[model samples]
Target: MSNPKPLRKAVLPVAGLGTRFLPATKAMPKEMLPVVDRPLIQYAIDEAREAGIEEFCLITGRGKDSLIDYFDIAYELEDTLRERHKLDCLKALEPSFIEAGSLIAVRQQEPLGLGHAIWCARAFIGDDPFAILLPDDIVQAASGKGCLKQLADAYHETGGSVVAVTEVPREQTNRYGILDVGKDDGRLVEVKGLVEKPKPEDAPSNLSIIGRYVLTPEVMPYLSKLEKGAGGEVQLTDAMAKTIGEVPFHGLRYEGTRYDCGNKLGFLEAQVAFALERPDLADGVKTFLKKYIDKV
Candidate 1:
């Protein structure tokens, strides 16, 4: 068989209504929420860029113009910053802007599901194996290489679809797509099967998939059927499950901390954790956190 094509592009599904964040998300996309100094979406894009992804396809929905605008050059803002000699401010915006023609935005137009959102990007993805990063799932790698980069390195070695997974408790198996094991090393598991949100008793293993995935383009046809599975929506997990044995699939246990910014508590925790990582803010945040904990 021909060698696997080099992974170049990535798809980010940012079309969710952000209902979990409620009023804060009323006028803004949840992915735009600030995590310390950067928006949640920016972190995902940075991770993809770190993985050598050159083009980005953002699957957007209504009222997501802010997300598109965020990656665009702010001519007026730059002018003001330059005029005031605010070099630092201008430098901060550099990474947020994508190349002139590398970014593509496709509209989802409905709240179908993750599978549907990904399927919308089929035209842009063409035939390349692509990476997918959920903005809400911010994964911080202790090794300095971003989570997607870690997965990309694994993909190059395995030459098939690779997904980032973590071992969740057995009782929590119902909350995620659990993997069935075929063979295992300490860091990677050969995926024999995948079940979407299976019951604790039915779960093949507690190795649950996170938001990071490097998928083969062959899965697009399965998603195109729009078949609603668990939770009565087009589940991406369902589509991935069909690819077993057809390709080499493996689950990567990345060394990272994942913050689920989709939920209230998780969002708060991420804010504090990310803040504590910043040198300028670390001391103050830690002091406040300790006092608050003692009072409670």
Candidate 2:
């Protein structure tokens, strides 16, 4: 068997209209919404960088130019910081910098779905195995590696395709793409089948596919078919399901907390959870919570 191609590129589908966030997202891309301090897209980029991804392609839609502009250098801002001798502030901006030509932004002409959004980056993806990270789902690893980094490690070992999976309530299976398990070895579960939003009775397992995925190039042709599934949108899970028998596919039970920033409640919970994790804000946040609880 030949060696697996290294994962060097990551695709971020940031084209959603974010109807859930409404007025706040009216003028800004939902990917630009701040989780604690950093934007959701920034957190996704940071996770991808942890996995040693070299290039990034952002699949965007109308009114999402701000997502691309975030990576570009702001000369005036840098000059002001330099003049003020704010060295620490300058250092903090390092993550926002992308080497020229390494980042590409491609537009998704319509709101087809996740699969179509990813398919928009075919030219940029070329023949390499690429990772797809959805910015709406922000995952924070409990200890060592980020969610994507863990998936990347698994992909390096098993090759083909690897996706981050987390157990959800069986009743909620219809809300996500449920996985059919072949083998379970604690951390990685061999993907025997994939069901896009199956009913609770039909779900094979509670392991629901999240936003992080490390996929092989072989899956692209399946996506190109544009077969609408589940929500009448070209689902990425449907295309990925086609690759099950052909390639080595597995779902990783990553060690982390996932916050679905796509919705209001999950977004609010993420802000508090992330704030509590930071040493600088933990005590203050805790104190405020306690005081607020006493008042209530």
Off by over 4 Å in 1: none
lDDT of 1 by residue, 81-106 (tens): 99999999999999899998899999
**Model 1: lDDT of residue 21:** 91
Q: All models: lDDT?
A: 0.93, 0.92
Candidate 2, residues 210-266, lDDT tens digits: the string is 999999988899988999987889999999999988999999999999999999999
| TM accuracy, model 2 | 0.98
For model 1, state the Cα shift of residue 111 in Å: 1.5
Model 1 reaches what TM-score against the true structure?
0.98
Residue pairs in clash, model 1: none
